[model samples]
Target: MMVRRSGRYTTWRGFKDFALGKPPDEEKEKPKPEDDLSNHDEIFLKSIVESPDFGRKSEPIESEEDLVVKPVSLDNVNIIRSLSEYRGNNIRTIEQAELAILLSRIHFKALIDAHDAIGALWLQRGSGIEEPPKQDKDTAEGAETSPEENGDMPVETVKVVGLRKVPGQPLGLTVTTDEHGQLIVARILAGSAAAKQALLSIGDVLLEVDGVQVDTEEQLKEAVSKPNDRVTLKVGPNLKEKSSQLTNKLSCYMRALFDYNPKEDTLLPCKEIGLEFKKGDILQVSDRKDPNWWQASHVENPDVVGLIPSPELEERRKAYVPPEADFVHKISICGARISKKKKKFVYESRSSVQLEGAELALYEEVARTPPFLRRVLALVGTRGVGRRTLKNRMLHEHPRRFGAVVPHTSRPPRPLEENGTSYWFVSREEMERDAHAGRFLEYGEHNGHLYGTHLDSIRAVIKEGKMCILDCAPASLKLLHNSSEFLPYVVLLAAPGIEQLRNLTFASNRNLTEEDMKQTLEESARIQRQNEKYIDLVITNHNNDTSYSRIMDALHALSTDHQWVPVSWIY
Candidate 1:
């Protein structure tokens, strides 16, 4: 049969015969040019097909009498004497049986030492200690004992606990296991049976439930899950230090982004701490140090305090978009035409003496429009689009008349930042609470921290009789436009073309990636298309000097020239 040898097929009967314990067929074993087997292959074949007698079989014995028994003789053996024995005839010695026992004990101790060394090495490699050291058979049999009998560790003190549960109501406590294999109370739900009792605390180790010893989390859960309205538990106080300090009281305001139902949530401890709010409802945050939850109350009703999800401010900001932007495409075609017709009608009506009731009301409203005392210059753009640089330049050029409002943030101040100069550093609870209370003119989250401009802070600048210039997110335009307190002049700071942007000397300093440039371009296009109506001016920021000059000219016009105002503001 043909066999594969090296890279070629060859009809070699020698290997087949050799494999079957037969001698090689010399004629068939002859090498051919087509058979590319190397010297190594020949040597391998010869080694595998060895002679039948290579590993010789022993011959069977004829009978049991053929075996001979031999004994070692002590007559020819020389016994060596110890040097100490020759010097002193009174040397203390142990009995033979006792000596054998001592030797066995020493051997066992050596084995245990070697085992411990191996276990230590394994632990150092992060595998963790596997099993306890094996005790000697005799010692192991009598080693079983209680903790008190060992007297090496403190004995745990167990306390009996009884909690009542209303039918179909939750027990309001969650359980988990610690490293020591103790069942611990993880969370006590508010307003539930466990929370009301005040006996169960977070980190309490559960020893028994309903008279049955419970060591595992599953056992404790099963014990508490019984149909009965009453449950009993035996627990021990946690010896470890508390993980978080309860002394700090953080305060803030927040708007609910979603609805929460305490009864439906298994993680909630009690109804008292269960916060439920509608989509737009603002909440007053009292504490936010908890890792997963925050304590807050509704802004309208401070007494209704409860626990709510501690979501980042960015999450809430993502939920907001200008209402008009949603239907920009539908209104874009007719918007300009309708605006022109209304303007023409107003202009023609102003010249006429007699007018309709609606037209007369409009005339009166426009006539009563208050003159601008101070105008807020708001710069809007995507991230890394030089809004901050432009604002800083404007302020630097006109520091006396133009001022910037210090934004408030829920993030910690950086090493170089001051409390009121760089940012108004506040806690998440405080930021959220104030935001929901309508204290902020604009707010958004970034990098897990809440950032917003408070209305009061802006008013403080206006109160000083200085115009406030802010570079803010596009989402804040509508809020600022509607506010009469600070008549805001919205300007879209469009990003220059990618080529122009890259050529700028300051572009490299911004550390902008390809994706960032692409996003900025996309966002610029979105603002122009969707929010064109809200934009009073557009500056394609190709050159810093040119853009600054244009901004100055626009600000000058808004301040000195006759400008249109909203009818609602006049009313």
Candidate 2:
């Protein structure tokens, strides 16, 4: 028997003894180089079974390649600590958690502090920052960037009793189901040192914490709320156990886990505060290097969509993004090729207008894309590409610069939901009356419920001189394009390459298995081929950092470079 050691394989002295059970003929045959057993761990070996990167060092980029690397320093850590402290000290409500998260760079450790800070902030709610004094109406209207003084300190912890989509609330972790359909925590961020000590992993199922039995998400959250530095966890056995025939007693057992000493990576009080401040609004920002940024968010600047004002600062921020040029946009007009053939037939549009007066050019120009146009942007994806989540991320990125398209539906609104706020939950009777009166621009059945987009949704966005981004299924795209209600510019997000499509799906942590990825990729390929006939412009999303950047680039080409207006604008 041969074992891999270091970088080479060697037969051990006791191989003959270990191989005693092998047949004589099998033993006679020499093992191939590929078959040589090595000391490599199973995890490393698995990758070798495919292709290996061993001994392959990272290469230096060409000067033209323009790759910039920044050394991660201790200062980044302190900044993270300051952000965490701010969240802990100032964040006041659950409603503000998501917004704070959107506004802040706090995650991982900061998230932990935000958890505690939110509780403390809630308890001492009187410390809320006073509102900024009113300015002239014209100044307020033209305010491109919000003052940092209006910013809230990141909240420490937010325990969501239920999974309700509050208009501006952040999505906190609750003990949830795993890919195997087993009850486990999808993620946890409470500052319960005990929870961490007890080794409560992201995928660990909560049978009970501290002997406070829990079965539902709510119960798990409540169990974690106990005031202590140490806690015990009763865990349900893993999926592998269930696959075998584990007994019930074996499946459920109480295990004591303790919060070990705070790791050096423990966010400082102030670092936690930084978590809740908008990355764009951080003044005197700390410099901290933390992995939590990668932990919570699926991708860092997935599309790399925003602009950078300072060349020096932009270089620093770009370090966090994946080292890939995201979304490369080009414009074509009158059937002429432009910057890249990849963008053939694509009319790019960008909403930004550079101005010199603001303290931060990027911050001021960030909100250039108005709410209405954004609604149109939302409609660009296939179902589950996250229309709602997309809207939320956009609004979070833009703040009050944009608002959601509250559909004027016929259904009655849910409790605490307002008429012209979260949504216009209406009556079926009114819906029917609107349908008969031709008030609906687009209508459909969703989640077995009837939902319609009335003209009012578009009107609301246009009222703000913004374009509305509406989502429609592939079948409805043609109708939307032809409709008299609006003639919106269409930039089709096509998943043409199967391999690329699979990467996008898998990257999203959407429980896509290998087979599912293969199947969806094939389906996407088919759709892309079919869609090619109708698409005016196509942007194939490979789910790389380039996807969003390409989209942004395309927008620039359409809106500014080429002036290729959508039919919506002209009509």
Candidate 3:
């Protein structure tokens, strides 16, 4: 039913028209404005737009709406028409004058708009308001308006800015009087009331707060303390100069190793704005300009900035130095007080050399990462707890998923013992040599045989794609906790109440005394206090079966829930 034609020339012409656009003759005709722009006026507007001093960019005029043409006043049009009729050639002589006329009109319109926005606030709305007498002008023409120091220096222009008070939030700034006796902003905390308003900046001079002249820092503080919902601040801001007090943002986070109560800190310049956080709370350390104090906010709420003690400040104040004999590893123990007891900590690394670290797990740098199964789950406990029973049950119940790092021993194999199954059999000489080389995490010469937990043994289980269940004493906990190579999730198996512990079969089988059980609880408390930051979880050994199930649930969570780890582990 359809007729086909070659029509190759017609198709080619159509394609050419699309690429090159319609010819001028065939293009749509747009109706011109009834009163068109004069050549001089058009050139004047274009010159103003193109001028760099005007700070405007030239854009293509696509339509009448885009151009936003405002017709000249009828009176001006009549004057121009009359001038053209009298001296047609004269119109070109003063064409440059149009730009001046256009600029004046724009300036006048801007003034009206600004007055409409803020002029009403200038009125004295309440009683007891007295206007200060005006002073003679001294600033040079086009001088910047900013906060001015009170004495000696030539006066600079001051701008009065209004700020609304936010309830239950600190003013988010600290003030101090300069040597010139003028109140100046010492710090402007990020995300605080002043920061959000953006009208105040660090180093701004405070002239008045809520209509009260603030010549000193005390006056500024008192004025800000008023219960008014809206407060007016007269400050001199220097937009041209940058203040060194402005904090630079750092992409870092710190986990609080110890509880901090700001009210107790005597050195805080402004105690009310000090940051308070409990142990293990992660903080986003936004600013670290000062070595003694840092600007930080909780990770859960980063909008409010507060001051917290710096790592250097806390390190010097809270550090507990141990004796040389027990300083086997001099690494920083975050949140833990160093115990001087030789048996509680390693005497030295296996290499016979002390580990080189001044690390006090004091504010430990942390990073959030994707869900990952930890390589090791190290169990630490007192003697009376069913810690060993719980760990063995996990291995027996899920051998494919859980594993144990076989401890190395130099003793001869007993009747039923096997080489690798029972223990990694080794010669005493080799054990001594390895222990001296720091190959063993914790080693000792017991009776005539050498026994120790080897770091390499733990690696073997992890290599097999199983989470190694490491049963080690408290002495080895520090080494494993800090080692990125092991990434152990340390859990402290605590003993239950003495009465509850006495009801256990294990306690009865050994004929443990009440005082012995009481001593175990005391030792458990001491261990927890020393390594509070390093411990990920604590489960009381009320029932062996219950503790086993609790540990299994936690192990499963390690693979499904996001975890926060030391930054050094990843980077």
- Indicate which candidate wins on TM-score: 3
Give one digit per residue, the lDDT tens place, for model 2 in 1-571.
1112233212422332233323343366443353445623543443543343521432332442233221222123434443433454347898667655754564555654554445444335543434234333233211112234222311111111111122322223334565655466543333323222223345445554554556665666566545554344545334443332221211111111111111222322112211222322311211111222211110222211111122233334434544322222211101111112131111111111121111111211111222223235434545334334445555666654454567665566677877888667777777767766656655655554557667677777767765566554444444454444554555566543546655556556566566765554444443333333234456666553455566556545555443322333333
Off by over 4 Å in 1: 1-373, 413-417, 505-508, 513-515
Candidate 3: tens digits of C-alpha lDDT, residues 1-571? 0111223344434433432333444677344443576445544554564577543433333443342222212123323322323322233546545633443464644644454333233333332324333333333221223224334333434655677789877788887766667677777787787776666767777776765777766677778888878777766654346446545677589888778889988878888899999888999988787678888999998876899999888877765533333322332233334455535332234432255323465678899999988888889887768777778888888999889988899998898888889699999999888887778987876677888888798889999998899777765666776678889888889878887788764544766887898777767876666666678989888887788778888988988998889887898
Whole-model alpha-carbon lDDT for candidate 3 = 0.68
lDDT of 2 at 538: 62
Taken over the whole model, the C-alpha lDDT of each candidate is: 0.58, 0.40, 0.68
Error of 3 at 505 (Å): 6.0
Better of 2 and 3 by lDDT: 3
Worst-scoring 10-residue span by lDDT in model 2: 251-260
lDDT of 2: 0.40
The alpha-carbon deviation from the true structure for residue 409 of candidate 3, after best TM-score superposition, in angstroms, is: 1.9
Provide backbone clash counts, one per model.
13, 82, 14
Residue 321 of candidate 3: its Cα lDDT? 35
- Estimate the TM-score of every prediction: 0.36, 0.31, 0.68
- After superposition of all CA atoms, the RMSD between model 1 and the true structure is 29.0
